[model samples]
Target: MNAWIGTLIALCALALSAATAYVQHRARKRETLGADVTAYFHRTSDFARIKLFDGTVRQAGYHLVIWNHGPAPAERVHLAVADVEGAAVELADCPPDEFPLQRLDKGARYPVPWIPVSDTHRGARRFTVHLRWQDGNGTQERLLPMRRGQTNV
Candidate 1:
């Protein structure tokens, strides 16, 4: 009788250990899924005709673009741009102060409006792009610095 009771207690302890390990595994999986939604923005340029006080001028303007590289989709996305040096910058064509991107799917790219740098901002070489979005887990925010020659996505 003593041996049977000891065996039963040992079995219960083993079962409890297995159950605890399974719960921990599931928690780790959930954390991994939440961390999978990584995204970033990059700098790109294109030429277009923009209107000025004098007339229309064809010029190359830079655009800040965000590309979703993760497997999950980003929702309720927003973006803002600012010069890294805190210098005054002018945009030939201004984008909205805040973007209301409803959804950005995986492998998708979203470009802000083209901003032609004026002579005053010529010395600025780096800019910060602030991005916020929601994934399957919750909301996330990132501030990325983009340089003239470097790109991140």
Candidate 2:
């Protein structure tokens, strides 16, 4: 009887250990199946002025960049700039406000055209970039704060 009781207890412990390990394995698998996307400012360039019969001046702005640093691809990706009460930041040559990206592969870089901030808004030093996407797990959203001359991911 003593030997039988010892064997039963050992079996229960083994079963509990196996259950715990399985749960941990599932958590790691779910984590690995998701994609990670990031955003940044690539660089700034000046717009060349055209010299025609009449001189015209054109100003240039900086480019905003989005990158996917993922183990999996991000699907149906969307990007937007968060609205502030009195900010004078504007996007130029940008994608539609609610456009979808079919897929963003891992390690891929996408540079948006330009985001020009009006010189009159000197207090607007930082803005938020709202990112949304779908992965294997589900839909996700991230609010990234971007500073001038700095990269935010």
Candidate 3:
């Protein structure tokens, strides 16, 4: 009976060891080979002319920017917006060749020339920017909480 008990305990210890090793390996792999991209709403003072949906150019100082903060490069970057606490928003009037970016290297920043459009969006906006990209490991994604008219989204 004592021998059986000892065998059971040994088995549990071995299983735990294997599980820990597996977790560590996965973490290392992702850290070294995965792409971590982030998107945020940026507030600027340029007040650049941005064309509205109705072909009317307006001066706005807010925009979106994408950055890859990982060791690996990101490919096929895509963006999606979701309203977390306030009105939903959609990007409109983007340049023709600026979207669906093909590649972005690590530590690189890309200006996302997009304007937010919504019928009922006003006053203290809360949203989420979904960034999806492909790396050596697989397709990785991240969600960034954002607020309008702020640079630290």
Highest TM-score, which number? 2
> Higher-TM-score candidate among 2 and 3?
2
Candidate 3 Cα deviation (angstroms), residue 131? 1.3
Alpha carbon deviation, residue 129, candidate 2 (Å): 0.9
Candidate 1 whole-model C-alpha lDDT, 0 to 1: 0.63
Model 2 off-target regions past 4 Å? 1-5, 44-61, 83-90, 117-123, 150-153
TM-score of 2: 0.72
lDDT of 3: 0.76
lDDT by residue (109-129, candidate 2, tens digit) is 777754343544323446788
Report the C-alpha displacement of residue 139, candidate 1, in angstroms: 0.8
Q: Which of the two candidates, 1 or 3, achieves a greater lDDT against the reference?
A: 3
lDDT for each residue of candidate 3 in 1-153, tens digit (9 for 90 to 100): 999999999999999999999999999988989778988766776766776657888655676789898899999998777777534466665544555789999999987544665654433467788888899998888878887754332
RMSD of every candidate to native, in Å, equals 5.5, 5.6, 5.0
All candidates' TM-scores? 0.61, 0.72, 0.67
- The pairs that clash in candidate 2 are none
Clash count, predicted structure 3: 0
Sort by TM-score, best first: 2, 3, 1
